[model samples]
Target: MRTKDENMRVLVAEDEEVLAELVATGLRRAGFAVDTVYSGDAALAYLGLHDYDVVVLDRDLPRVHGDEVARRLVADASRTRILMLTASASMEDRVQGLDLGADDYLGKPFEFPELVSRVRALRRRSARPVPPVLERHGLRLDTVRRTAHRDGQELDLSPKEFAVLQILLEADGATVSAEELLERAWDANADPFTGAVRVAMSKLRGKLGEPALIRTVQGVGYAL
Candidate 1:
C-alpha cells in the first residue's frame, strides 16, 4: 500500500520538446514530481529505472513508437497507468489506444488542468489499498485527509516533508535507502548525488521533535 503523496510521480513521454516541457512544468506546478523524455526509447529507459504512478505518452513517438511502448508496458504487467496523447480525436482512435493498454486517452490541444485531473485520477485508481489512517509510535497520519500528528499534536509539514514522513512510517521500522527515498519522494529530475533526502529528513525529524522517531543507519539510510 502506498500513500497518495508517494504516488505523485509522473513520466511525460512526448516527442515534441516544447510540449513535453510545458506539460512537465504544469505537472510540477500542480505538486507532482515529473520527468520528461522526448523519445519513446528514452521513456522506456526511464520506465525501466524508475517506478512512476502514471505515464503521459504521445501516440506518435519516434524510435520504438508509443504503441509499442504501451504494448511492452502492458506485457510486463506494469502497475503504472498509461495515458495516451495524440492529435487524433476520432472515437475509433481513442478506442484503439485504450485497447492497446492505455488506461486513458487524451487528444492534443487538451487543457492542462484536465490532464492533471486525469493523471491524479489514474494514480488513485492504480495505488494499492491502504488504511485511511496510519499510526506508529504515537505518530498518526491520515492518508486521505493528508494530515499528520504526533502524540495528538498536529504537525504543519511541507508536501515533501509529509511525503518523507509517510515513506518512513510505511517502512514499519525498516531502513529506507536514500536512493529509494528519492525515487519515492522526489522524481527523476532530482540529482542522484544531491543531499535532498538528508535535508528532508532533517526537516522531518525537527517536525517530529523530542524522542526522535527517525534513525539513520550510518552508511545505509533512514529508518523509523
Candidate 2:
C-alpha cells in the first residue's frame, strides 16, 4: 500500500473536544504525528515547544483567538503551515484566513480525506521536502508507498520503525540526534527520557540485516 506522507507533526486547535480528537485520530491513522488543544493559548504553547509541520486551527477559538495565533506565528517567522478551520465557509472568511498567512482553510463538517490532502500539500511546501523514494547504499525506502527494501528484498517494519528510518534517510547521512527523531516521529506526550528511539533503532537494524548501515556517533546520535 502507498502512503502519501511521512510522520509530519501536526496540531489540531479546536475548542470542540470531540471534533479535535476525531481529526487527530484520522491524521494519526494517515501517518502523521498529531497533538490536540482546546484553546488558542494551549495551541500557542504547543507551537512554542514543538516544530509542527502544520496547525489545523479553528478560526473561532477560545482564549487567544485563531487569528492572533496565526499572526504571532507569522510574526515570529515560524515555518509551520497553518490550515485554518471554521464553521463559516464564506468567501470572505477564506480570504481573511489567507490574508492572515494561513496556508490553507477548511470549513467545519468537511471530509477527512480533504484535510489529509491539504496537510500533505503543506508539508511539500515546507522548508524541506523529501522525495517519494529514498535510496542510500543498498537500502531503498518508498515513503509514499510505505515500504522499505534492501537489495530488492522487502523488509517488514512497524510504523515507528518506518518513521525513524524515513527521518534518518531524510538526514542524508548526517547524524540525527535521538531527540530530533522523537520530536518528529512521536507526539508531544512522548517522554524524552524514554528509550523509544533506542528500541526502534535496534529493531530497524535487525530488519535491515547484514552489514549494519546505521552508525552510532558515540556521544552524538545515529547516522546512515
What's the TM-score of each model vs. the native?
0.83, 0.91
What is the Cα-based lDDT of residue 172 in candidate 1? Answer: 82
User: Model 1 segments beyond 4 Å from truth?
Assistant: 1-6, 29-31, 125-127, 151-154
Best by TM-score: 2
- 112-156 per-residue lDDT for model 2 (tens digits): 999999988988886556888899988899977789999999999
Q: Per-prediction count of colliding residue pairs?
A: 0, 1
Candidate 2 displacement at residue 1 in angstroms: 33
Model 1 residue 204 CA deviation in Å: 1.9
User: Model 2 Cα RMSD, Å?
Assistant: 3.9
CA lDDT scores, all candidates in order = 0.87, 0.88
Every model's Cα RMSD, please?
3.1, 3.9
Candidate 2 ranges with C-alpha deviation above 4 Å:
1-7
Judged by whole-model lDDT over C-alpha atoms, candidate 1 comes out at 0.87
lDDT of 1 by residue, 144-173 (tens): 577899999999987788778877877788
